[model samples]
Target: MARRILQASFVRRAALSAGWLAGLHTLAGCAPTLPVVVAPINCPVSAEQLARRCQAPQAIANGATYGEVLQLHQLDRKALRDCAAHDRLLAEMIVQCQRTILDYNDRLVEINRRIADKP
Candidate 1:
């Protein structure tokens, strides 16, 4: 009777250990994912986009009366101001992009210099 009980207990422990090992083996498949590669940023402002964004408003007709012409001049001045503001913004954006490119180039040059100097 004692020998039979011992045999049964050994069988039960062995079965549990096998099941645990099998579960761990299946779980190992979840690791080791592939790395993702990213493309470089190429955000150039297109000519078509510039043409569409900063277009001038329709031309105003010449006024008949002196007061009317003065009011028209005011309107024309405001339109010019708006156009100038848009142009300044575009210029600033171009300068900023140039600065960014130059900054990155400098960094890359430094990195290359350091790598070349390494033993």
Candidate 2:
């Protein structure tokens, strides 16, 4: 019957797929794995470096002209912005490093599982 033939074909295809997957797994297991060493993430500017990079403008002298005070305020705002930019950069670096560490831990778990399952 046609139904019987279809069932037989399906079974054959399933068996072939299973065998192919097993062969691929065997081949992957035979690959040479090298050691993976991850260096620690570095993300911090020293106090001196930070001070040198972002020093706010000194306060205007007493009885200063309006223009001088305005200029000083603008410089102070720019300095604050520069400091915030540095902090944001550092925060992004930390986030990326944390994600990488998490992924590395996950891969390590999978590797351990495969090692344990190996014959």
Candidate 3:
């Protein structure tokens, strides 16, 4: 009887260990993943730069106005769609453009926050 009890306890411990290992394996499989290749930050121009250029005298002389914002939106949408259809290299350029614009905007937002926080 004593030997049987000892064997049963060992079996229970083995089963528990197996269960724990299986759970860990499952958790490892579900671990969050990050992109292996980070997007490059090689943008020469940004959305703000584009906006400023669009407001320049040449653009204004071409009949640009405040209401031309809609036209800008349409142009941007068309360019994005074209980029989406481009081959891998062009597509990467498009993504880089987007990242650069976003990085610029993030910096602009931080600057605004700091200005607002000034006493």
lDDT of each: 0.72, 0.77, 0.65
lDDT of 3 by residue, 47-107 (tens): 5533432221222336667668667767777766654454444556678889887986787
Identify the candidate with maximal TM-score: 2
Question: Which pairs clash (backbone N, Cα, C closer than 3 Å) in model 1?
Answer: none
Runs with alpha carbons beyond 4 Å of true place in candidate 2: 1-53
Which has the higher lDDT value, candidate number 1 or candidate number 3?
A: 1
For model 3, the superposed segments whose C-alpha errors exceed 4 Å read 1-86
lDDT of 3: 0.65
Candidate 3: residue 81 Cα off by (Å): 21
lDDT of 2 by residue, 1-119 (tens): 99999999999999999999999999998876644644554444455554455675777899999999998899899889988888787677668868877887787777777667766
In candidate 1, stretches whose alpha carbon ends up further than 4 angstroms from where it belongs are 1-49, 52-63
For all predicted structures, in order, the TM-scores are: 0.50, 0.53, 0.30
Q: In what order do the candidates fall by TM-score, top score first? A: 2, 1, 3
